[model samples]
Target: MKQINIFSIIAAFIGLPVLFSSCEDVLDKKPLDLIAEDDVWMDASLAQANIYGMYENLNYFSHWNGDPITYRSGGEGYYGWDYYNSYNSDCQADLYWGHWLSGRGKDDTGWTPSTDFGWDAFSLIRKTNIAINHLTSEESRNSIGVSVANDMLGQVYLLKAAFYFMQARKYGGWVIVDEVLDDIGAVAGSDESAAQKLKLPRATLQETYDYTIDLCEKAANLLNTDAPSGQINKGSAYALLSEIALHGAAYLSYYDGINVDAYYQKVIKSVEELDALKKYSLVSGAEEYKNMFSDYAYAQTCPENILVSQMNESYGYRDAPYSHINRLLVNFGTALLNNNINQSFQSLDKGYSMTNAGAQIQPDPQMVEKAYYVIDLDRKARRFEESQLFAENIDIVMEEDRWVPGAMREKRKLKPTSSYTSISDLMYSRRDQRLAGTFVYDGSEFLGNTIYFRTGGNIHRDSYVDKAREMGSMTGILYSKRVPQYREIVGNLNCTNPIFRLGRCYLNVAEAYLSLSTPNEAKAKEYINKTRVQHGGLPALTTETGGELKMIYLDERVAELNMENDRYLTLLRTALSWGVTDPTTGYPTGEKGGIIPELNRGNNPTKKLEIEVPGDYMVEEDFMKPNAYFYREIQVPQSDHNFIFTPKKRYLLPVPQSELIENENLWQNKNWE
Candidate 1:
């Protein structure tokens, strides 16, 4: 999205902050001061300027503060958009790290619904409502071209629906404010009725769903199917509808005591509609797949991206800072791009960007287990043979440490470097291409240097060791999806975050079919095969039922959508389907114990250090024997770090205390008080 000078015109009249602009390629100018309400509708460009502001104001990563890789413990921050923040890949450590100790409050004591994303939405909703009112006014058709007006109006509805969908999912049912609250003075003045009108209570869950779906329907009717990546088109609208419809069906099936095959059918149809557009498809090949996340340019045009949050550029007029996901994956003093020399003398440039590594958010051991299971990587060596795991396979290790297979030609052609051999190279060589592509494995030739992250390696250790202890032991698996190889010189970290992907649609369709009474296993298998069998090269899932199939479907999500902000919602919705009922006394009044508890169960493993006697000091026979040294002591659980989440209390966040205080009619959600 790009900023324009049109804010001078709009802000002068409306007093809104001028922090937004257009997301398109062109900008048109019209005289600002002369544009009255009557004249504004006559000029299409002016109406569009306001609409453009709406696009700019839509909550993208750049718009929100706080690290995307870590949740801010002081609740949702000022913007109150904690849904994705709490659910993003960064927050997975909370189960062990205790990041979310408080439930939407400064401390564990106070939390209210108003401070949540549900209430944060009113800011954007009001802006969009104003755009909708203006664009749909009787004079709008006369002022702008009918087709163009409808296109702009379609965007407004789409955005409005998105806000409503977010609110409905997070805050259950809240009051719907569709009309424009334009006249601030009139609404805030000493009139009791006007103030009373704004104090409406929550709406029904069904009503919120219906309203959101209706807006999407209107958007699908008005917008073009082949819209730009940044813009909301029919395909995007349908994709969102498919997701919303699935949620509605899931909610109704378990919570509302309603059977919703109709919703499941709707999900299938919506996904089909998106597919019919033929605009986007998954990027194929392992290198290309990894690049789809790291390379901004490649991802912008990648068919897999249905919707995205685009950062303009870096070091330019509109250059936005890149997301520092790389820093979150690697440890400090750990050379990136494979420069693993222990001692750093002067003039030694590693040619890679080194990070602070303090904020590194390693994958949960459970998540690593799931990933390994998804790709079927053999961990036999890791399971039972500890010595064989890390030892260099001198006999099988390729000459000059040519770790990667099928690279013998390159090995023969080029002279050997100072790189050493290790068992990690052999292990990585046997894994699925996607696993190698998505994570930083123990040994891989990154750029030119061999990357290593094992214990006692050349890389510096910080909390990596502690986190490993927390997870029982480190698996040497770290996130690498968005960690670019050339980040230091790549100009911008502004790779458009993939907000929607057709691959996900395929998975969703499969789940929807499987969720039916007479499970459409064949149909589910067909859809699942499109990505898993064809792209991933994994064997087709044949016969599975009940919990087994659900687990498979969920594992697929973990493999495909980790760190993309889908996990939290996946866990929440799945828990609902598990028939979670309102507890008699707990805070999770109407929620279920889902995959989160399962993932967080059990204590992590601990590792012991071994020492060998020096050859000179030991007898010849004694030299061969191993002696147990000392193991690292377990950390005493700190009050904050020792947090144990009560499912009922922690699942749904509370409204802001301010909201409760201001609105006498608005009470807190269930046990939050």
Candidate 2:
């Protein structure tokens, strides 16, 4: 495997005008200073630089910490940023109140096709077409070696398909533009021949899927089997194929002339092909699973990463100081782990027990309640013990008009306190290990600091006097998933953002199996249990079948790939699976359900547990008192953040108004028009 400094190459090619402009703009005015089209094909280094530019273009559209879809999926919250502050995907989904309050929905008068919902990646697609045209030419193959040309060609095909897939999943179908209309001449022509040449009608949703799949297959055939991580390879193509096939199986079969079972079979086949390569595996053990997203994993060549967007400090690709992930999630305290999602992880000791109907039975709520009380008592006892140690060992000092714990004084070393034993630990530690790996609650340790999200505690929203500083977790939880633990400062934090992995591929297979016309329960369970046992450190699932199995599978996806997966798409597809109907047409809208109805409307009310703090902190006798307790077991009134899913056809995005005006042949998505 050969490692390419792709970011460095991208930096060098950053000044290219063709990569940044629209198709019309690119053709209308050719910059004299830029590299000539003919010269790019003749020189291998310049051609590779063009390809690297395409990869950099992907970052603008790819799902990462900064992507709106990350917040839209209800996987994580976004705060501090002016646009999405204190909002998540649930706002659009009607799971919360932000969309209505902010006037930002599809039906809002201010809504425009130019917004985030519009399709704008055609420029990237056109760039790929240019690359593909030149790379595939016989003259270029003679100039650049045949092997290098083929590899570059394979990457462009994948890139073009990926750009289309991103749009297809959001907008259903896009206009097919495979050829470079180089001979169309300047757009300033009075005849308007070049402008008319570009105005192609949109392809159907089914056709879009077919086009994406065909390109992925071609990429798989041409891509290197052992390409390094972050680079597109055979595995990348197969993984993408599996994803598109699964989505097509779920959504396209409803309206398009496609068989659901056939699409499912396609998903299975793609996964099987990728699996046969034996190129990647799920990172094993609890710590390894957590480290899979850290710099440690990036340095050690994490087996889980199939395709990644590599950000390196050495290449000047560091995260922005003000808006880095750690600042958003921890320092400025913008994003929080959703409370409902935090409570969804299954207990590690528990295995599914079969009911009389052959469905798996879950743990009783009453038993869970009793366990919570028992854990609460233990937590209080531990806190008292820790408070005594802190009082005896550490000194209290006045810092900036506030009483704070002083750093280690002289000979007395501060003992590690039991601050780690909050209700979160009792609730989470014994459950799926992935929960702790993904979220930091009241007592969780992060970056060598004890995080306290409880009311009146350090990281709580109420602790800040300045309104601008009140950006802590509203849900009493913060996301730790893919957040590096080694770096205290995040301005220059370098890490790989995973795009595809084997764990997700396994889930894709499980979903396809469970979704088959004749649902393969046994096969689905086997695939689900692989992640459950290995990544989650949970017992192997047994006897879960039918609707129960489907429920378990959905839960598994949330636990294993919540932040990473396109969860909004998953929810939409699942709604279709459950026979949710379209509101306007009253049709059984497959994979497009739940978006246009007041369905799955729920709230994520902020919860604050009342903990009784002893007065006169310097008094040792206060800790020695008989009734000195830590938690009062009283919960504050829940904050109202209820959901209201607007009834509109927002399943597919509208074609950009600007694009539609420019190309009159183009049509808007069904509901948008």
Candidate 3:
């Protein structure tokens, strides 16, 4: 027997009141009371406000006080919006390891179908649908002015399509609901039950993509070419369309009655349209590229940002303070740079490579001594300067007793010494400029602090032994990409979260070219080289076979978009393209395909280095010896690798068990039942 509809169940849970009241009672409200539904459409500003409510769902970070708008809804703890990205990175990507020993890794059997997908943004879709219905009505168009109504409708369409796109990429096909429905228990005028009206069957994967594409096109047509910052425009619509089409093309064989080539062409075409607008370009220079992601004010005017989620200092404070990207990475230790990512960056000469082979060779003793001397000199100078400044700024006051000192005032408090001279800096020097911009390694300067990831450093250290297993970068490096470096306070960062940018668009076009039937290697090389040469500060790629070029493209993507949550998605898409089959049906899973079974676990060896203590340096921790020692990279022990293999069914998350129970029409993903 059919059960309740998922939307109706969600509606009841969220306490969505009846949207419309009787016409007779509409005028009974006072001026300060809630505006009637009819009044909302009559005013352009009210209609615009209705659309803006949906924008709240676009933020990737959870609110300070654990606002339930973006991700899972428990306090501002582990269930924040960044949790899903961190979870995926920890389990799958080569850029991170979520401490497999603790059972948070891919081999953890505790992960199950009951896990929250965190992309159930249907509530946003419902709101968008309601707004669409209002904005498209003849009365609304006449009252709010046709131009205003069309613009609002454009935003609504983009939002509706965006919500569907998020779900479709994860779960494939979904139930399509374009119209608002009555509450589950609302009275029905017809003989048909309200449950029957609400129970909609899932559409085919092909139909879902087609409908989403249509909505994107509609939005592109209605939206203005230019929009205010943080608002949707034709460029945003086309950028999203390009991304959606790229995913469709990746899973080409899974969809019936669809041409994979056509999807690729669609991606190219959408990107081409966005390019024709002549509004965006990749930010030049390494500093500019870093600033594009790290600085909020720069991002607003940066041509690279086609779409971005505007964040501010105020967002960090609410009912309960929410953690921002900086706090999550530094304070909570949610993710760290998996030492493996360092190899992706090219050296300044573009010929010398930082690889495992190079890492195995020990540095010359003379060079090591020089590095230590420079490190010590710099540390001593900084400390003396800090002490002098502190002495200059303090004001001693008399207390109640004798001439006792009161509260001493200082301009700025210096960060604790977290660095000791290490040989790893020699290895990292002269590599890609982006490496320094993206990660905080031993001896790196960040926000007036020398960040240390050494074994016994002050701020943080690599935890190998069980007793020292505290919240720190287990991989000996912290992911600093897109993290605002100038924020003096941890959670006060006001960085803009980039949703879509020209750099990604160029890569999408390049990937499409390489993925075409004929394989346009030249075209692919051209598009990929734009960002590689401009942002990476490296030479343009040379000629190569389609397959070789594809490999190069993946590496370039990793170098450019590593910690931006693109690695996991790219890995999944690559698996699909390799003809990986669905676990249950033995069909091509497309973008939902799992990585190679042998490579599913976190197998990247953590890096470590051991160095002799220079002078009279004493470690604060009693666990360390006062004598010689330095840290270097080493493989994790085999005993720690005792993880169960990930089941194939985990590639695509299961439709929430709660939804499955409430809506019998909703089916579990393949192999999930």
Better of 1 and 2 by lDDT: 2
lDDT of 3 by residue, 485-594 (tens): 55454434465556678888889889888777677888888998887778766556675654445655766776676545565556566566534433332233443354
List where candidate 2 sits over 4 angstroms from the true fold: 1-6, 12-33, 60-62, 65-116, 182-192, 228-230, 296-300, 314-323, 332-422, 467-471, 580-592, 595-644, 656-664
Q: How do the candidates rank by lDDT, highest first? A: 2, 3, 1
Q: Give one digit per residue, the lDDT tens place, for model 1 in 84-162.
A: 2442222432211222321122122223333343354465676676567667776787578888789888988987887
144-183: candidate 2 lDDT, tens digit per residue: 9898888888998888887777778777888888765544
Model 3 lowest lDDT segment of ten: 354-363
- Candidate 1 local lDDT, residue 217: 81
| TM-scores of the candidates in the order shown | 0.72, 0.73, 0.70
Q: In candidate 3, residue 549 scores what lDDT?
A: 55
Q: Count clashing residue pairs per candidate.
A: 14, 3, 15
Model 1: per-residue Cα lDDT at residue 192: 46
